[model samples]
Target chain A: MTATDTAARMLDRGVTPERYARGWHCAGLADAFRDGKPHAIETFGAKLVVFQAANGEFGVLDGYCRHMGGDLTQGEVKGDELACPFHDWRWGTDGRCKQIPYARRVPLRARTQRYETVVRNGQLLFWHDPEGSPADHDLLPPELPGVGTDEYTEWFWETVPIKGSHCRELIDNVVDMAHFYYVHFAFPTSFRNVFEGTRATQFMESKGRPDKAADAGGYGDADMVLTSEATYYGPAYMINWLEVDYKGFVTEVVLINCHLPTGPDSFTLQYGITVKKPEGLDDKTAQYIAKKYAEMFGTGFLQDVHIWQNKAPVQNPLLCEEDGPVYQLRRWYEQFYVDVADIAPDMVARFEFEVDTTKANEFWHEEVAENLRRRDAASEADAPLEGAGH
Target chain B: MASFVPTSEETLADQRLYTAGWLTSVSCQDCLAVVGVQKNSAHHTSIQWSAEALAACPEMGRRPRELHAGCPRLQASIEQAVRAGQVPIGAGDGF
Candidate 1:
């Protein structure tokens, strides 16, 4: 309460303090699932609330029970109301605790929390900023295939959360295609990365919308072939879109999503993968696709979960050339936190791309395909015969 | 007699059909699925680890011991909880 202190406090008050601009965190996928509904994602930061509207369109809320810090998912879903287990209070999608069955009359102070949800592509989206409405801001994500449909089957994502601000470093981890050979060691050597009809070099700035580049016309552009796109703002969250190369079988979308400003050095990422099956495919084929993804992405995901849980949110500087265009990219992420606030996007950008339909051939070649085929045959030497009775 | 399907590596299936008929619940499902899916195959454990692989399932990779190292205390707690039926996650039902 000193005069100088009072003056500084007054200056800080009502200043908005350059906080995170909440919006789409997870891609639009987690929603009221058919047959198998969306289960809870067990991370501390977000409360996943999945609501299937009358039209089968789902709204996945951010899990902040607006009433008394309660969780929305814990509520018993009625025809219209999800009754809060704590108080038997009912809340409709409008976010109002509409009824208290046990109460004599609807209380004047009763209000159930609600979030603005939009499903773009397949990921169910909830604007997470805690301040803005989905109507006020753009609620759509960069487009991907099969995002708007509920027919596709999805693989269960292993919840591996890292503690830290998800910034340029994490996004680059997916953008840098060269790492598959060495870091992940998938291929023996690195391959060419193409962006905008030219071979990309380093990553352009990752500060703006992932599709929008800050150093678009930089002195020399970076070369990268992205199977996906990433975007981040303030300390809200970061999202990376990776298109699953399903060999043209069906529409497949993959995304890496995480929260930001995880207290200087710790952040968590929840990775969800979705795949669309072929038309007229039986339930068996759908199950096959899900199982395949669980292997392909699940192994790597488990590794990330273990390593990141034990690792730092920030880097220790032992970076390699294969590391994405991270030198400038990290600076962009830090800027969103420290330097820039109150700045909005220049203009609305629409992201739409055709899913890569190239079948696994030619580049995959004969030898590799043959090897996989043989391996598969050997493993199924004694598998069950069809209709042998389940 | 419960039916079991015989699969080969070439036409490997992603879903290992548990043809135990009525024995598909948790109690018998895991054990039966393991036996039925393997069916004298070389990669019996492969189904346990990477059951998602198609065409030819590969040998299971080296895994961290801790990942599969289930704790007795945790196991006991989970079993007790299951036996106590589904309780709310935050409920202090001696879990």
Candidate 2:
């Protein structure tokens, strides 16, 4: 069948439902580990926790218990299951009760809610797409080298409350290139050129802030690529990718962001700083790495958070003709945010993800040098054109 | 922002209301009148409300007289001249 026909069929009501701005989203909950060790992940107005069984297998569960809505995280972690602290009602990853201390035996109806979950590409993937249909595939970044390594890496995570929707801010930040220069004024250049690689791809940069009073061209190459696409996972969340080639410059440098739901008016940001361990790395290496990422990339994000938080607490509007990926992202998000046939309450999980933030801040120094070199070249070419052979 | 209102042809006899991410609209037999709203407000500020509340809604105020806060009585009062509509709501600027 043609794509249009398939698309229409995919969108037909009663076939699947879309809730939230996108049907389902991945928040990079945890890299590894489980034994009823609950990891809570919030995104797009939803809260979920994943309990890791001692046997390395696990189950997805609603973060809140049906009985008194007590947090299941603090409960006892048995062999490959969990026992609710309030009433000692035990459950497995499938959300079914394994035993009931207060009952004669396990009741047939004693089951904690569960959701359809799949572990893919080193991350746990869940359906947040409105239809919660299988047709909506898993969303993952292209596999890069050293994705899940404990040798040169260590990870820690902190979930911060952000008062705003994740899609608008995420889509905005992923496609925004100009902001890198202006918004991040801590760097040398205030403006940077663009090298468009295609409709939705841009690589490298051209010119930026030029320094006239100083020695110029003392910089090295610093490059990044921006790619955007719409995925089956959701319509609103643009499937975006950014690849930065730092070429042995910094001690530790990374950029990462994932969204989760905290409240209807807010979401949480989960990031990992992929830091290559330094020679004398201390035990608090994760903290050092996170500090660098927060200092560099996180500040700029903080500014964006301010803007997003202050915006109307509803779906932000955009015109496809103006906003590059807004059209597809909006279409994708509608299925999750507006459609109801896709709502699933059992999708919640306790998220505890790995974040290696150990790399040094050498990249900013390189960036400054690169900006200086460009300025020097432009000035040399622009200055005293030898009276143009009059 | 668009200065939009249901075409005069629209009448309650024709249609009903629906909501989107930030938009809520009353669709009649002829046209659709839409207003942007914070979706979370539904937990407390529902489709049911007073005329003053309807007049305070974004885009709903453009024709405050037409927005009934989903209350038939409010609409009936304004339609039958029992109540007088006031200034528009949510424009962030005095009209």
Candidate 3:
């Protein structure tokens, strides 16, 4: 076979760079970064080495060094530069050859590709675009109650590595509403979906009982109706606001689901959850509730993971009357994988759908206001007698 | 005693001299982090430096990481050394 044809066959073996969307992909949680240490992670069909300089500058460089193709992960971090183990060639955070221990002259072309990085909500994200263009839109981390404040417990994170499926396959599961009744064993009473260009929102009410729900934090150990409002920033990140109602009482929990594609056929599913703490609750109690809620969500999400691992890629499937907007969702997802020129006008038009999540917004906004009020009150209490002291 | 000229002394005092001290790696006294530098490329063997890696530097907690990376003090030293034609340019095993 010709060399060009062979390269084409190789691209088809797994997801090539062209299939990668222009968006921010999760690098890892903020706590994972250590100063003066290099972290090597595989994502977007490349091996990336991330490191924090002695000055606290974060840099993402191509894992291989320019000289002798040395593996940078084995290299030592020197100040803000990474020193390659093979030759002690020091690379600056900008991927430029800052120093060569044995050579006085540095090559002009001695540099590697550096990915753009941004830290948000305690998570590090790197922008990936096939064409090397800057990110067009900003992906904001959802504003949830207790985030960055003591009023809410910190997010308890759980990671599960999946094989034999692409990240898009996992994203597709979000819009597959029918799976709740069959796979998760929850009966959905109503479902609403909204798709506007890059973002999609799904609001659903499911009738189910928590296997072992906590009594504190307004949660109960009884049968409850679960209402969920999920907002997708893109195909990679989602913020799901879940409200568990036990008769008159309701507790809100926000689940931030971020999927990082490790390879063409593999990805890591990171699930982080934070629960709104009840007033007058101790730190220990709040932390316990957060952990329990995280585990509960982990248990439920794994059901979908089990099915996803075994299922093959279905390009086209016979649609039933009851199946939720799977085809329309697929049309929206096409823009991520394929170029704009390849997509039809009719498919592009399907991206304009809307769902009302007014109640969910009210619930979150109220919690934020309460947290701010409590913070203000605490600050006032700490203030000394300003007029008398002067 | 008199200031010796380059033709008589063989090494200029103003030039960066690569001394034996350049081989020794120095770290921040506070954070105990190693400072990055070229050991043998210049006339002066050893140089003193400081850096902060983040906004809240775990070591000093005073400067932003970005400011530390692009510190004018370090840049000014390099620029002065280069303009004076004192920094070595020929191929040699870098220190």
Judging by TM-score against the true structure, name the best candidate.
3
Model 3: residues >4 Å from true position, as ranges?
A1-18, A140-146, A209-222, A246-249, A340-390, B1-95
Q: Candidates sorted by lDDT, descending order? A: 3, 2, 1
Query: Scoring only chain A, what TM-score does candidate 1 earn?
Result: 0.54
True contacts kept of each: 0.00, 0.00, 0.00
Q: Worst ten-residue run, lDDT, model 3 chain A?
A: A211-220
Model 1's CAPRI class? incorrect
Off by over 4 Å in 2: A1-18, A21-24, A27-36, A39-47, A67-69, A117-125, A129-142, A150-152, A155-158, A164-166, A185-254, A275-294, A313-325, A338-390, B1-95
- Name the better of 2 and 3 by lDDT: 3
The superposed Cα distance between candidate 3 and the true structure at residue B54, in angstroms, equals 44
Q: Number of backbone collisions per candidate, in order?
A: 49, 50, 17
Proportion of the native interface contacts kept in model 2: 0.00
**Compared with the true structure, what per-residue lDDT tens digits does model 2 show for residues A262-369?**
554466665545555556667377556545544434554665666677754222222211112232222323324443544222111100011111111245456656
Reference-based lDDT, each prediction = 0.37, 0.40, 0.59
Q: What is model 3's DockQ versus the real complex?
A: 0.01
Give the Å error, residue B45, model 2. Answer: 44
Candidate 3 on A1-390: residue-level lDDT in tens? 333322432111222233566566777776687756788887766788998777777788899998999999888898878998899999887779998989879998998888777766667777776667665545555445457577677878887888888776777766665566456545555566655455666777766413223211122133557888887776687888888765655667888888877776788898888877767778898788678778667776787788888886544343332334444565555565555455444333312122222333344345535854775677876543221110
